[model samples]
Target: MDQSCDRTRNSLSQSPTPPLVGVETGPASEFTGKYMVLLRDGEMKEGLQAIKRVASLTSVCVAADYEGAAVRMDEAGKAEVFVLDKLGVAVVSADPPQLRRLQSAAAEGGAILAVEPERIMYAIEPARDRLAILDYLRGYRDAVNRLYDSLTGVPGEAEKELAALTAFTDNAEFTWGVQATRVNQSRFSGRGVRVAVLDTGFDLDHPDFVGRPVVSHSFVHVQTIEDVHDHGTHCIGTALGAQQLAGGVRRYGCAFGGDIYVGKVLSNQGSGADSAILAGINWAITNSCRVISMSLGARVQPGGAFSSIYENVAQRALTSNPGALIIAAAGNDSNRPIVIAPVSRPANCPSILAVAALDSNLGIARFSNGGINPNGGGVDVAGQGVSVFSSVPDSFPAWDQPGGPGRPWPPRYHTISGTSMATPHVAGIAAMWLEARGAGTTAQGLWQLLTGSAVRLLLPSRDVGAGLVQGPV
Candidate 1:
């Protein structure tokens, strides 16, 4: 390691104060008053010394000090610098003078790659009227199914079969998403592969996952890996739920045999800092999880730039030995036929697969974002998102069910709509592809396998990307 703090000290004596790395553009956006420092590959120790020398920081917490990048959050919260050792990135709390000095070190080109402010991210599902939208889309699907049945001849059994094949809907055996995506027909079960879902955590006590293999940890401060918000449970169910559920209702999951690594990055309130997310990713990559599903993001403006810190991390994760592919939600910030918001941050990064949502009709979801932004901000794939059926925590309260619309009673299973719901479908299918393509498959290979085999829709590439992701035959 470059233990020459004296060199940095000498350079600082002659050089002028450098500008801050990043500025907050919006008043509404929340920052943690900390900055993310991306270190050059294989220079982690050197980078730490440079940062500490430049910033005059005292306390530092390295993930290696703990087990499996699982730094004690309480201790980490008190440190001036917290390093995700495996990821080669640091979350730094610095004063103005210290920040300027650190920027100078980065400019001088020694170990430090880049520096940016850490922003808070949330579960990509919108907070308002989600159930109402699901109800409306369900009604729309039912109407379309009824119309198709009425148009078919009432005499022949073959005509009924054709109608069933053409107009897909949630049946007694499988979810509409599973049927539409052809997951029910795929021979691959994603066996032996590991899938990581980073979100609001998961329900360990959920009966559907009783015998399933699950490895879980929490990165959020003062929180457990247990899911209280219901988002993580839903996403995990879509990705790794069993082929046959406990209640023996509809089968909703795609990868029934893959290992589930649950990282509680977001809090029970459905929000988390960038540092926690990065830590979660580090944990996943360190554990060699082949497919990482992140159904969470921070919304960006029309021309917002993707985070270089996250981009570098994802790119390295893809190209590293036994690499992993990262999949994230494209966001639910748009109103179709009108305003179309750009893809969300982190997901907007080129190295991360950005997934958009599609309804049962194979049309883009009304709230699914588009690839309107420049650079790497584009939707890479589409997945079944609207009115998608999946599992939730058993403790989840019952909503408008029984006499009401199609919501499940007892609340063990629930149907919702978002790009959040769509991401895990793509992730679980990626697991299947990894298993089908062979054990030697890399992240780049998996990416090619997915985009190359996608079903091209009639919509523009910006909206549907390569189109709906398909499973291996």
Candidate 2:
């Protein structure tokens, strides 16, 4: 078998030959985006070669090497192509010069995509077969006094076993500080900021977000925003939900009045495929969702994954939308020496703001992912993640009973815990910063403020990241 296709043997196969590109549902008239049938890996080079045979297609460009790939990944003027690793998530190693340089530059700005070549197959395929394997591994995430054999697709649990995690218990003590840090000057409501929740769909009727117009798109099968799931809705509510029940007193989130974009990239199963994820990301970029909260990730992926796509998208969002934000959950299944892995593509994205989880005391969540070590590893900032409260679909298992197997049912809202819950906090803060700036800020500028305003904390013995995520200064 070709090493490229060796990534995973998927259990799900699309019929109708899976169009190379086009809307997954309904008529092609809904979208005008040109569609390209990206042949599976090994076929990419040949596919491009075949395209060269057609002289009728005048508008065409070809790239040869990694440099050419980096250059043509869209010329900073067209759509971006972010690739997930064969492992199904972001790349973890840093042996390749390109990836190393890209990760190194991440702390400074949001640009550069792709990483490591020897350790990672740069022209690799997105692995979806392994998602099911990884999501199942999370089942044993909380078992104490057990040494878990690292699975092929799941993450490490050393962090979770090592410590207890938490988040704000009430809103009172945190709100004043939230206001003081990023918006001590702004007195008006945060009515206009746009937050994109690119996880599972959100609870459209949750009281906290009742009137927040939810414009959403689904890449997962025929599912829509009306679908219910714990992870996606949880992250959505945290960022811009009017008020939360944490640390007491009714607390308005960092962006209490921001509008929302619910991008349902993942499915009701709490897991998703890399291709679907990439499509969702492209949609977010094209739609101009300024602050997107992605509380989902793949457990495994090659190092420096998706450089071309992320670089292009980040460039567009920064240049066009300015002040735009991408916040992602670090991962749960912590408390150990091994940190949980990141989602495909974004995990290694320079422009993305990766978030871990914290307990009420501001200690890193045992299950949250941390920063990369000097030798080459992941590094991430922590946020509150324990017993997080958020909206759930009407049919959420914890809140709703199954009428029958395979029966039609609507979704509802509920509470759950994971780094997914922590991500929205930082996203909300970014929106507040954007609102306060009044003028569009640079990606580097927004990152500086976010890191600067974050409250410092110690964890993982190496002091992995800056500290607790807070409003921008």
In candidate 2, which residue ranges exceed 4 Å CA deviation?
1-168, 171-189, 244-252, 301-323, 337-345, 373-377, 398-413, 460-464
Residues 240-358 of candidate 1: C-alpha lDDT, one tens digit per residue = 98997886778999999889999999888677889899989988987889999999887788898999999999999899867999999988777776789889877999999999988
Instruction: Please provide TM-scores, in order, for all candidate models, with all chains considered together.
Output: 0.87, 0.58
Best by TM-score: 1
Error of 1 at 374 (Å): 1.3
What does the lDDT read for residue 276 in candidate 1? 90
Candidate 1 segments exceeding 4 Å error: 1-27, 124-167, 399-407
Q: RMSD of model 1, in Å?
A: 12.4
The residue-by-residue lDDT of candidate 2 on 384-405, one tens digit each, is 6544444445554422333333
Worst 10 residues of 1 by lDDT: 1-10
Highest lDDT: give the candidate number: 1
RMSD in Å for all candidates: 12.4, 14.0
